[model samples]
Target chain A: MLKLDKVNSFYGRSHALHDLSLSIPKGQITAIVGRNGTGKTTLLKTIMGLTVKSTGAIDLDGTDLSAQPTFRRARAGIAYVPQGRQIIPDFTVRENILMGGFASTSGRQVPALVGALFPYLTENMERPGGLLSGGQQQQLAIARALAANPQILLLDEPTEGIQPNIVEDIQNIIIRLNRDEGLSIVLVEQNVAFARRAGHHFAMLEKGRAVAAGPIDSLTDELIHQHIAV
Target chain B: MLDTIFIGLSVGSVLLLVALGLAITYGAMGVINMAHGEMVMLGAYTTVLASIHLGIGLLGAIPIAFMVTALVGYAIERLIVSRLYGRLLDTLLATWGVAILLQQAVRLSLGLAFFGITIAGLGTGLQNVRVPAYLSGVISIGGEQVSLYRAFIILVTILLTLLTWFIMYRTAIGAQVRAIMRNPDMAAACGIDVKRVNALTFAYGSGLAGVAGVMMSGFKTVFPDMGTPMVVDGFLVVVTGGVGSLMGTVLSAGLLGQINGLTASVSNDIIARAVIFAVVVTIIIWKPSGLFSYKGR
Candidate 1:
């Protein structure tokens, strides 16, 4: 389990996440839902230790990660698929995937699971990542995260800008990653229907604070209207 | 004419050495290292000290100078640059301050005067490195007389350049550096230790500058002020070449070196410098990004 207790994250002088606490249980999907500019991305970045400054406790399993750097945090088994799928454009698909392998305890190698899940990436291993379509790029991002051999995956809006058909595909992949593979996931999602379908738990955020959180069954439509609606 | 071109190639080789360090440091870290020239100065001083104390010649000083400057670079990164990451202007000012401190430190003999310890080769004076007997000779190829030392310099540069290329393109560490160069955040997220790699990269670049100093000590007067101008020249080459491109640095160093050589051959040294400055200005106005700029981060 990954836990954040009373975490306050900052970007330079601007406070992005304020006194936020969260817990990601093992082998389950927890959807973080909120409107635009509501600290959803900030929460993910805070978890990854990418913010300018942060105060409070971040624990992965039994180990305290607040003092650790980003790479160490990654090596401790948290893999991030950031917004915009920030893969290296010039690097080949193989290279992009291997980048995540640097964080893996097993060392740098394309996991067998990547080949099984992303046959298109496997087939065109030498092609530059920028050449891939949006759907393909999303797949590549997931494949890259998988290469880290991470126990916990933090996916920030994984289906934000993809085509409708590819969105369903990615959604299924996320569900499979959690349910079938038994990997824990923290998903920052905009689509409420998809979140309700896939997530076992939910956190509703507002203005850098978690306004509501609990099991998916308790994620009422009224809570969504109060916090997530524009 | 052929001799003049050879001279140009030699001059370009020196520029390449100086610029290579700037290119990597500036490219990878977005830092404008003003003390890089001091690294060259330290390298020359290492040559002087090694010859006097260790009885080692210029060839032997190459590795020693590299190590000395590399260690200094590592210290600078750990103590200063590491803390100032993402603040470009602040780094520029901080490193410039470091350059002045280094210059004064050497002038004061590292403050050894308080202890009354005096070193012969380390005072504030102009020094020259001695060339071995064989290297001082000239070789005739195709009835053209070529200075063997110049040829050796060119040969060394070519070999080093090739080695740098191989490391950057073929090695795993090199891949990490390139990945960092493109996108530092993504690189870090991928589990690469950006700070560790950056420190090593800084040391390697500074080490290259030290090698350049050793080469310069053979032909130019070695003094505290010698490195001041070298930093400007190195930055010029880096800017004219693309900021982070190894290939760009190599090609631009060659181009600018040739311009200086060919112009100096035809006219005077001052005029040659002026012409080179004009050419650089023209190039910058034409392509602000550089000749072989990489489009993305």
Candidate 2:
């Protein structure tokens, strides 16, 4: 389980995430839903220790990760697939995927899971990542994260900007990873219907604070209208 | 003409060594390390001291100089450069201060001047390293006579540059370095220790500069201020070639060195310097990013 308790994150003086607390249970999908600029991304960055400064405790499993650096936090089994699918443009697809293996306890290698799920990436392993389409780039990003052999996956809008046909494919893969691989996932998504479909638990954020959180069933349309609808 | 061209090649080789480290550090870390030239000064000094104290020859002093400068570079990264990662101007200013400190440290013989004590091979005085008997004389190549030491400098630079290429492209550490050079935050997110890689990169670059110093000490009189002009020359190569492109550095160094050599051969060293500066300014105005800048996606 990954837990954040009263975390306040800052970016060189501008407060990004206020006193926020959230828990992501093991072997479950927790969707973080909120309006634009509501700190959904900051929460994920805070967990990854990417923020300039953050106060409060971040516990991953039994390991206290608040004081740990980003690389250490990743080594401890939290893999982040950030927004924009920030793959190295010049790096080959194989190299891009193997990059996540730096955090893997097993060392650097393309995991069998990546080859199984991302066949296109496996086929184009020699091609530069920048040559891929947006959907393909998203797949490469996920494949890269999976190579880490992470216990928890933090995805920030994985389906955003992807083609409509590939969107469902990506969403289904996210569900399968949670159900079949039994991996804990913290999903920051804007598609409310898809969030309700995939998330076992939900957290509604507002101005960097979690105003509503509970089982996915408790995420009422009223709550969505009140906090997320713009 | 042939002798002048050979001289240009040798000069270009030394410039390549000096610019290589500056290219990597400035390209990867965005640090304008004004103290980079100090590493060269330290390397030349290391050769002088090694000869005087340990009775070590020029060849023997090479590795020692590398190690000494690398350690100093690591310390600079850990203490000062590391703190000023994103602040480019601050890093330039801080490293310039470090450059002065290093120059003064060498000039004063590590503060021994205050106590009226002077080390034999140190302090504010010019020094020279004797070339080995084998490298002291010229050899016939084709129909031209080439200085054996100059040939040795060219050969060593070629070998070191190849070694650098292998390390950057064929090694795991190299991949991490390239990754950091492209996107530091993403590299960290992928679990690459950006700080560790950066420190190592800085040390390696300093080591190369030290080797350049040793090469310079063989041919020129070494003094406290010898490396100051070298820093400017090295940056000229880096900027004209392109910040991060190794091939660019190599080619531009050769081009500029040839320009300097050919012009100096025709006119004077002062005129050659002016011509080189004019060419660099033209290149900058023409292609501001560099000759072979990496294309962003």
DockQ of 1: 0.70
- For A100-202, candidate 1 gives per-residue lDDT tens digits of 9989999899999988888899999999998998889999999999999999999999998898888988899999999889999999999999999999999
Over the stretch B103-122, how does candidate 1's per-residue lDDT look in tens digits?
88887788885687767677
> Which stretches of model 1 miss by more than 4 angstroms?
B114-116
User: Which residue pairs show backbone clashes in model 1?
Assistant: B182-B297
lDDT score of residue A47 within candidate 2:
93
Candidate 2 per-residue lDDT over residues B264-295, each given as its tens digit: 99999999999999999999999998898877
lDDT of 2 by residue, A80-144 (tens): 99999999898999889988889999989999988788889989999999999999999999999
> What lDDT is reached at residue B96 by model 2?
95
CA lDDT of each candidate? 0.92, 0.93
